[model samples]
Structure formats: structure tokens, C-alpha cells
Target: MNYFIFGGSGFIGTHLINYLKENKAGSKIYNLDIIENTHNGKSIFINCDVKSEINLNIPVSENDIIFNFAAIHVTPGHPDYDYFETNIKGAENITAFAEKFNVKKILFTSSIAPYGASEEMKMETTTPMPNTPYGISKLVAEKTHMIWQAKKNQQRQLTILRPGVVFGKGENGNFTRLYWSIKRHRFFYPGRKDTIKASIYVKELVRFMVFRIENKNIDIEIFNCTYEPAFTIEEISNSMMEITGMQRKIYKIPAGILKIAAGIIGAFGGKSIGIHPDRVKKLMISTNVSGKKMKTSGYNFHYTFDQALDDWFKDNNKEYLS
Candidate 1:
């Protein structure tokens, strides 16, 4: 079987490619991305962007699988139109290409942003109430994939994963920022410490993706990829300290003051400082998602939050602590 991964040069895609190479060896793998494939040339790279039509001259079979991870996901980083232009258009193009090739299985990596910034636990059954352009576009993209599956109900299979804050090697996201803040003794709670930040390890996410597609009995399944009883900001911070043996006094600042400060800093060309108003707002909100579905499906999570952090540190050659 052949694996076609769009956006395969990205953080999650890179990890997925590595996982497939180690586990599903001998399978033909093709990485279709606009960026260069730098994962030691494990998969065939195609210089293709998903925002436009996907044209592949290589041979493909109906039994082949397609993984779509293409999206402009960073909030406050891009203009509103950019998110829709890329994410929605990318989904449309990807599904169209799949239909053209008669590819029956598609696995999409969506985000928990569709649930909005809520402290309430979100499950697959929760109604999507997206608040941002990125969230709305992802929700629409999910529908695009669903529409494709519905056209060939019996023959097509679609698995949509809504993961929150996925962190691991090469992820220069929230976890990385937190690590740096604590290591530099500059970590602090923004507004409050009880805000839930549902997260998952990239390795576990890829494993679950494979497990769901291989063992699914339904035509389309939507699963929330996060730890059940999601960790609070304080809990996560404390865990990081314990795991890394790094201790620092964390102070809680009022959300309003931080927002004003971030605005002033951003207005005066403090972008490189990595303190934006939007990011500050994000810290104050909660993304309390649930992963009970994956657990009840008999899939075992190989890494706890702490273990995942430890593994990520090792993967980075322990440079995070250094």
C-alpha cells in the first residue's frame, strides 16, 4: 500500500513519516508538500502546494491511503483571509485529488479550536462553536472530508482527529515556550493557574491515527486526541518542574494587565519578544478536551504527560534543559 501525506514536511507530518518508516516499513511513501523534505530523505518529496490543484504523475491505486495535515494553523500569525484561503482550499483540493485517484481512506488532523476556548470538557459529540478563522476553517475542512466519504459510504473511510496542543521533538509551540520560560526562571501563570490546556504527544497521536484507520469498523469516526481529565496550567507547570528538575517561582498576573502590556509591546515592534496579546488571551482560556473514546477503544497510550516530556527532552539531545 502507498501512503500519500500532504504537508509532510511539517512537525506532525515529519513525526508521522518517521513512525511509518519504522513500523510500516516497505510501504511506498510519498510526501507532497510545498516545503523541502528534510527528514533524511525517507520519503519521496513532491514540490506541491495543497491550496491549488494537486497533480501527481506517479501511479496510485484505490487502496492507497491519504493523510491531509495541510493548514495555516497559527492564530494571530496570519491575516484572517490567509487561514481560509489555505485551510479550506487545501481541504477541497486534497479531497478532490483523492476522489480523482479513487483513494478510499483519508486521515485528517484537525484541531480542538473548533470547540472554542472553553473550560468545559469537550468530546467528539460536542457541537463545534468555532470563534476564530482558523477554527472555523478547520471545521469546514472536516466537513469537506466528510462529504467525500459520504459519496462512497461503503467503500470510503475517513478518520478525523481533533488534537489539542500536540508537543514532541521539533514542536516549537506552547510546550517549547513553557520549557524555555521555566529554564530561564521567567515562567509565570497568566491570569489564573486553573485554565485547562489539553495536550498530547506527537508520537502517541500518530500511533493512534494508525490504530484507528487499521481497526475502524465505521465509515467515518471523529475522535478527540487528548488526555482524559486534562491537566491544568498549574499541574502542567509543576510536572515540568518535577521532570526537568527545574524550579522557579511562578507568579500569577491579572489577565487584563497582561493583555494591555502585550498590546503595547506588539505595537512598538516587540514581535520577536514572543509576547502577543492573542497569545496572552490564549493562556487565560481553557481547552478541556476528552480522550475517553480512544481509551475505551482498547488503544493504549504509551506516554503520560511527564513521560512524554522526558522523551521529548531526550529526543532533543537534552538541549531543552541545557
Candidate 2:
């Protein structure tokens, strides 16, 4: 099988490459990213922006699977316009080219951001009230894929995946952030450590995506691709402690106080505030996502938040720590 993927150098993309190499052997995977090479063997890196490569000049065929996993994601301070152009325009070009190239399946990695800041576990069917331009752009990107797929009809299939905060070995995502902070003893849970923050490990996410690719016969395909049971920041913190034998005092300040503090920061630096005031607000709130669709679609999560954190780090030689 020929699989063409965009953004294989970063967190999610790299994990997907690992999956393809380890599990999808004998398959040729083309990784398209703007940066220079980040992987080795059986894969070729295309040092071109996803938007630029949308010309369908690359070797995409009707038999190939195209995955769009590229985006300009910078939380807490990314400009709204850059977020829109990269996330929205990137999606537009990818989907358009997928149509033109007659790609068999297009898998788009979106975010739980589209579901807004939630106080409960969100389902795939839940109504989305995107809190930030990033969230709005992600939702728009997912729609663009659908629109293109409909136009191309049977020739193309589109699968949209909304994974919770994705974590992996050496990831800058929530898990590693908490780990590093805990290692430094600066990690604190502002509201409550027990707030159910939705997350999935990178390996598990790639596993689910691979599961989908191998078994596309299933219908009802949109998935909230996180670990089945959600993990609270407290649970995650505790898990980290178990893994690293690390411990730190966790402080819980009132959410109101944090809001006031953020307001002060916003006054001093508007752009420094984040995509929205509630970016942190959303994280503090419970936003667990169930992987019911992924499970029913023959995909299963390989790690609990605890297991995913503990087991992978044993390979200390790996560069995920960097």
C-alpha cells in the first residue's frame, strides 16, 4: 500500500510513522512536511508545505491513503489569522487535492477543541461551540474534507478524528508538560487535580488510525479517538509519580483567581492571552471523550493513560525526551 501523509515530523505524525513502519510493513509511506527529515528508512520526507504540495503533482494515486495531520498549533499565544490560514487553508488544499488525485481514503486529524471547553465527557455527536479561532478552524477543516468527499462520491472516503489532548513519549502535549513540571516541582492544578481533562497517548491514536485504515469496511466512522476511559489531571499526575517515583505538592487555587490573573496578563499583553481567555479555562474544565466509535470500528486503545506514560519511557535512548 502507498500511504501519503502530511506532517510526519511532529508529535502525532511521527507516532503515525512509527505505526506504519512497525505494523504496516512492506508498505511505502510518503511523509510530506515543511521541515527537513525527521525519520529514517522506508519513508521519504518531502520538504514542502502542505498548502504548496496541494497541486497533486506528488505521487498520490487512487489506491493510496492520504492523511492530513498538518496545522499551525501554538496554544496560549498563536495569532488568530495564522491559525485560520494554516488550519483552514491547509485543510482546503489537502481536501481539494485529495479529490483531484482520487485518493481512496482521507483521514483528517482534528481536535476536541471544536467541542469547546466542557465540564463533562464529550461525544462525537455532541454540539460544538468552539471557544477559540483554533477550535473554529479545526471544525472548518473537518467540514472541508466532508464537502470534498461528497463531491468526489465513491472515489474517496473521509474519516475525521477528534482526539483529546494527545500525549506520547517526549511529547510537548499535556502529559509531558505535566511530567517536566512535576520533575521541576512546579506542576500545580489550579482548580482541582481531579478535573477530568481528556487525553490520548500518541501511540494509541496512531493505533486507532491504523486500525481504521486496515478495516475501512465499517460504517459510522467519525470517532472521538481518545483512550476509552478519561484521565483526570490528578490521576495523570499520580500516574506520573508512580512511573518516575516522582512526587510534588499540588496546589489548587480557585478558578476565579486564575481568571483574574489571566485578565491582568491580557491587559498587559493582548496577544499573550491565548486564542481565547478560556483556553486555560477549557483545560481546567472536564472534557473527557469516549472512544466508542473507535472501539466499535475494531480499534482498541493499547494503553491506559497510566500504562502509556510508564511503559514507553523505559526506552530512554529514544529522542522523545528532546
Supply every candidate's count of residue pairs whose N, Cα or C atoms clash at under 3 angstroms: 0, 1
Q: Residue-wise lDDT of candidate 1 within 95-170, one digit each (tens)?
A: 9999998998999999998888777779899999999999999999999999999999998999999998898888
- Candidates' C-alpha lDDT: 0.88, 0.74
What value does the lDDT take at residue 285 in candidate 2?
77
User: Candidate 2: where is the Cα deviation over 4 Å?
Assistant: 56-58, 218-220, 258-280, 317-322
What tens-digit string does per-residue lDDT give for candidate 2 at 189-229? 76777788767777888887877766645222578876667
List ranges where model 1 is wrong by over 4 Å: 216-218
| CA displacement after TM-score superposition, residue 158 of candidate 1 (Å) | 0.3
